[model samples]
Target: MPNVKSAEKRMRTNEVRAERNRQFRSRLRTALKKVRAATTAADATPAFREAASLLDRAARKRIIHPNKAARAKSRLTVKIAALG
Candidate 1:
């Protein structure tokens, strides 16, 4: 549908970026789930670490808001603490 060459290229790049962002978001959700599903502090510790790292990366990349990342990390930490 793009009528110009540059427009066509932009469309292609946008599609690729959208797909990549989708995959990254999916992975981030999985990481969050892993942390929440953890039954023990020992298990949650590592899961939280990985999830926190992913959240930080996502925030830095503007995939998710920085405040959201901080809130998620704080809630997960509280949940992990409650497990102990």
Candidate 2:
């Protein structure tokens, strides 16, 4: 438990931020899954674009590492190419 008033406030703010980060992470995972599940290159293209956008946003916000986002985007692009 936070002993000081300021510490308590910080704890509350941290909890709020954690929840928001969780939501962003969940959305990112869903977007990646959608792209990977796509059966055709045409279907995957839109999903990949959306996932890439989400990855960039998440990386910019520090929810995920920038290199991790880049790696995911690269792997997804490869998968899409393989689908063709």
CA lDDT of each candidate? 0.97, 0.97
* Clash pairs for candidate 2: none
User: What TM-score does prediction 1 earn?
Assistant: 0.96
lDDT of 2 by residue, 14-57 (tens): 99999999999999999999999999999999999999999999
User: For each candidate, what TM-score against the reference?
Assistant: 0.96, 0.96
Instruction: Name model 1 segments beyond 4 Å from true.
Output: none
Please provide, for model 1 over 1-84, each residue's C-alpha lDDT reduced to its tens digit, 9 standing for 90 to 100.
989999999999999999999999999999999999999999999999999999999999999999999999999999999998
Worst 10 residues of 2 by lDDT: 2-11
